[model samples]
Target: MFGPWWKLGVDTTLLAFEAQAVIGLRLAKLAAGGSAAQVEAQRMVSEKVLAAGEAAMQIATGASTGAVVAGYRRKVLANHRRLSRAPKGAAKP
Candidate 1:
């Protein structure tokens, strides 16, 4: 397993895995006009990936102070909340 500092987006393979996790069985959902759900799912992936990558980068660069980690976490969580509020009947994208 990748360490906490792993940046999932930078690696094509990791991103492909993340996409598969969210979209593999959800094609039908999209076709059913489930864009909101898809968007929400993508948001979760983005939050998780970004947190891991940013945290790792911070520690790697000796910048993972308490405030830095807390701020990064807050940002990720806030983004998730925003993404999750999308309209359920939103158009498919």
Candidate 2:
């Protein structure tokens, strides 16, 4: 009866968990401490904000929820890839 509703909650929780892990890793990288790292962190924030704004605009223009979500999902996966990779010649975490 409540399967769809419960599934919605479960899916949302999983997405949050995944995003949190990526965020934590990103913070750990930033914590290594350097001007370049800080700058890169700021840039990442700006990129996310821009993407969110774009998504919002798509919704305002009557785009389907799935389309907006798919776009954001792509961005999140891309960020995860970028954040999880070790920079060239950098020490392992």
The candidate that achieves the highest TM-score relative to the unseen native structure: 2
| Residue 21 miss distance in model 1 (angstroms) | 22
Overall local distance difference test of candidate 1: 0.56
TM-score of each: 0.44, 0.73
lDDT of each: 0.56, 0.78
As a whole number from 0 to 100, the lDDT of residue 81 in candidate 2 is 90
Q: Which one wins on lDDT?
A: 2
Q: Write the per-residue lDDT of candidate 1 for residues 1-93, one digit (tens) a residue.
A: 665445422443444454454453345445555665578568657877877887788888887455454655466445445434545687866
RMSD of 1: 9.8
